[model samples]
Target: MNTLFIFLLLSTISSTLGQESPDPVRDIDGNLLQSGTEYYILPVVRGMGGGLTLGPRSDDLCPLDVVQENLEVDNGLPLTFTPVDPKKGIIQESTDLNIIFQAQSICVQSNVWGLVEYEGHRIVSASGTPGNPGSETINNWFNIRKFDDHYKLVYCPTVCSICRPVCGDIGVKIDENGTRRLAISDVPFKIMFKKV
Candidate 1:
């Protein structure tokens, strides 16, 4: 009876571990892309508002090289700003900017805080109140220029604030059937850019 109990316990633990393990290929989206196979894992922190973090525990994926290349190709210039932290896995374009994600609402910092421009025009700027969540003054800060045609997006947690800009060499090809396709590579989570 003792032997049977031990076997059952061991089996249960094994099953639980297996179920919780992350499968790189079968579970990862954009894992089949042809670009390259380098991935970064982020952690999801509570009370941090919306957006996902990419470090160790978050479920966001990013195609670092590909994203950068695409942005450069569209803009006709390489990214001028460096990511905040590359080694520690904290990737951000500008640290001076703050984006807030509320329940069904989004807010940005302020124009007085300066702006992120593309092609000499203010493409990314903040125009919202500091503390008011539902005020119009807090409504338009989360703005992206060429919103439908051009954008620089990276894999971020599902909440929509935390984003990592992809750098390095990468390329993307649209299929003949009018469907957007990505290459297969190892990535922790998937980030996509859509015209909206």
Candidate 2:
């Protein structure tokens, strides 16, 4: 009887740990977003300009900051969403993940989106190395959360248990030059993933 009780307890724990989130992140066509697949993170709001692109916020910088394209132009580089555990195959909502741009940046070698402090605000830019999920590269991790009927990008990573990362929703902040830059804000930038 004791053996059966222990076995049942372990089974319950394993099942709970293995269970996936209630909703898996899907593309515009209602298809599950697979790991390593290329997609464009587009804003759901009508006049939010275009998808995410890479450019310097001010004078030429090494790691080009992420910015939104012009309103009439929706051409932005494709991005790959990689979950912390690649074995999961599908990206589930609220799971810690890494977003890497497929295109190469002339300024910096890394194309992974990471948070960097510029002008007293945390802004998303391409300056991260993939795979290291500790406190060292805690800024590299991101999350896609469900917002209303759409979704939003979040910077709340759970990869490091001992690290207390500043958690916030990712939104757009216009720079002095009138460029929309992705930054941590109280109001999230509602978005949807489009598979390329």
Candidate 3:
């Protein structure tokens, strides 16, 4: 009888211990886990004719007669600048002519290095949409250098499909009246990126 009671007590204790304990296997990785990530949606503005030379055929004149003459010669005819309706054409131009080109979002992935804080190790992914239907993936190692109390980010070595070679230098300033501004040299589009 004592043997039977001891066997029942052992079986009960084993079953209770099994039910109280938790699972030992864990599927989480310690290194790959990230806590916080930052994002910046930078606006890339490209000036059309700032440093460019203004020639006779270029669209930099006020009267614009020389440009009209060149267009007439290219068309093989004397193109007369006759307004369809003079009354409707003589109006004040008040709207802003400066086009504002901006990017959607820029994703920057910051990974923690050895014994150091997360310092933006990799630009894992980049994407941009030039206000069009089909989007484009910007895949190239853009140069990020420091210049005169600011950082210059130059995106090149990759060309866009519709626009010209998307290249620019962004200066990041951290003082008062000093803000992050991008000066795209000749391109007519913007670039955006995000973290994956």
Candidate 4:
């Protein structure tokens, strides 16, 4: 029927339009990033609430640093640099800055291990893997790429059971009826780093 055809056409058009492309890498305030400036990354849910920031000295398995969002930037986790040259521990394919963090207690760093879109969004089911002990070349799907206004977290159904970065793991979502949903590919988290 004509309705079916129209529906299909609209669907295709929307899909193409909504498709996220590589936007200019910006800081939490949607500003161009400085080379070596430090920024704090925090987690926030869509149309719901924010907080649950990743901080230092977190557990090796999940790294649940902060459960609530706070104005304190220094207390949150710090990320720096853009993924420009491959030889310099590139975060992803594009020239976005590579995240710089190291947790010696559990053998983990910003070195990612999956596909990362230029602007972190719509992570097509990827897993993060920490590379060698002292190296940051691991091809982890770290969708921590910068975007205007806030940092984005890639939707990953499956995450590293043992070690993961600040933006690696998915959080939990509970419905009004008390139904718990896995914050995998379903709900993506948009993060923001407080600027000093």
Candidate 5:
């Protein structure tokens, strides 16, 4: 299905069948989110090889690169969104989100924060996944929703909602010469999200 059509469908569905209403979609300035929760994420367009997952990452590669590189080698497993801090609604690729079965965070320590302006991209960062340590504000906040019966991380930004990862595109291969590794296409990422 077309991405726009799907988004329109989700807009309609989210208004009625959607999970939370008037639920504070973004954290532009206010911090309206609980602390310590997991929300899975997906890319706008499924890349040539795999999907986007949220989880821990080193300070070197951007968070998304962690998945992009790993999935290319290992089986393409999904990822989840863990918050850096519910108040700030920030997320960076750190061990704080390394909860078991946790979604591999893509916001690297160089660093990246997934959701805030949107909705439940994530909700508060724990001590971090088990690697590096540090945090930041929600300049790149976004949200995901149950759109058309699937999950998606929608990033229709007002300003600076997302960062630049030139190598994020499919088949782009690794970031040569220290190019940015994160990428968000015009299409929002879609994935299967369950509350388990």
Candidate 6:
């Protein structure tokens, strides 16, 4: 009987250690982020332009790249988060999500955010189709991670078990035209979510 009790104790400990509880992402008001609810991703740092927005691309046929508004007062655009599991309603930290803009665009039918290779750099852009979460739409997967006291956007999709994706911290790259475009960088763009 003692041997059986010891085995059960060990089993309980091992199972508990294997399961990790999801960390809920909170907004500026300290409320948990609900999936499909509109939120504005604003920079925590004062002078880093405004929230995320779509910028004009030289090629009209291609989708617009995600950028920060040059003006300090501009809130940019509002976006919604859709978790990898369509049934999940809460946005959790480090979980794959689809960041979709609430605005309309004529250049692309879908305003879902996705990564694209432009000028030898991986940049975030629109035209992504969400809902299908896997290696098929890996580029469309993004996540919010806890950074210091705020949060930052990260591109590390785990939806595909066999696909290898370019994982990195999402930051801004200032182009010659002075546009602050979102790109993969060593330094992350510190951000915070504000419910709209």
On a 0 to 100 scale, what is the lDDT of residue 138 in model 2? Answer: 96
TM-score computed on alpha carbons, candidate 1: 0.18
Residue pairs of candidate 6 with colliding backbone atoms: none
Full-model lDDT, candidate 6: 0.90
Better of 4 and 6 by lDDT: 6
Please say which candidate is ahead in lDDT: 1 or 5: 5
| Pairs with backbone N, CA or C atoms under 3 Å apart (clashes), candidate 3 | 106-193, 107-193, 107-194, 107-195
Candidate with more favorable, higher lDDT: 3 or 6: 6
Tell me how many clashing residue pairs each candidate has. Answer: 16, 0, 4, 15, 31, 0
**Which scores greater on TM-score, model 3 or model 6?**
6
Off by over 4 Å in 2: 1-22
TM-score of 4: 0.39
Provide the lowest-lDDT 10-residue window in model 3: 109-118
Report lDDT (Cα) of residue 126, candidate 1. 24
Model 6: residues with Cα > 4 Å off, grouped in runs: 1-18, 59-62
Instruction: Provide TM-scores for the models.
Output: 0.18, 0.90, 0.19, 0.39, 0.34, 0.90
Encode model 1's per-residue lDDT on 86-147: one tens digit a residue. Answer: 13222222121123211121222232111222233222222323322222222222211111
RMSD, each candidate, Å? Answer: 18.0, 2.3, 25.3, 12.4, 14.7, 2.8
Per-residue lDDT over 66-152 for candidate 6, one digit per residue giving the tens place of the 0 to 100 score: 999987788889999999997899999999999999998767558898988889899898878887877789999999999999999
Error of 6 at 22 (Å): 2.2
Which has the greatest lDDT? 6
The global C-alpha lDDT for each of the candidates, from Candidate 1 onward, is 0.24, 0.88, 0.24, 0.40, 0.34, 0.90
lDDT of 2 by residue, 51-99 (tens): 9889886776766888998773585889998888877889989989989
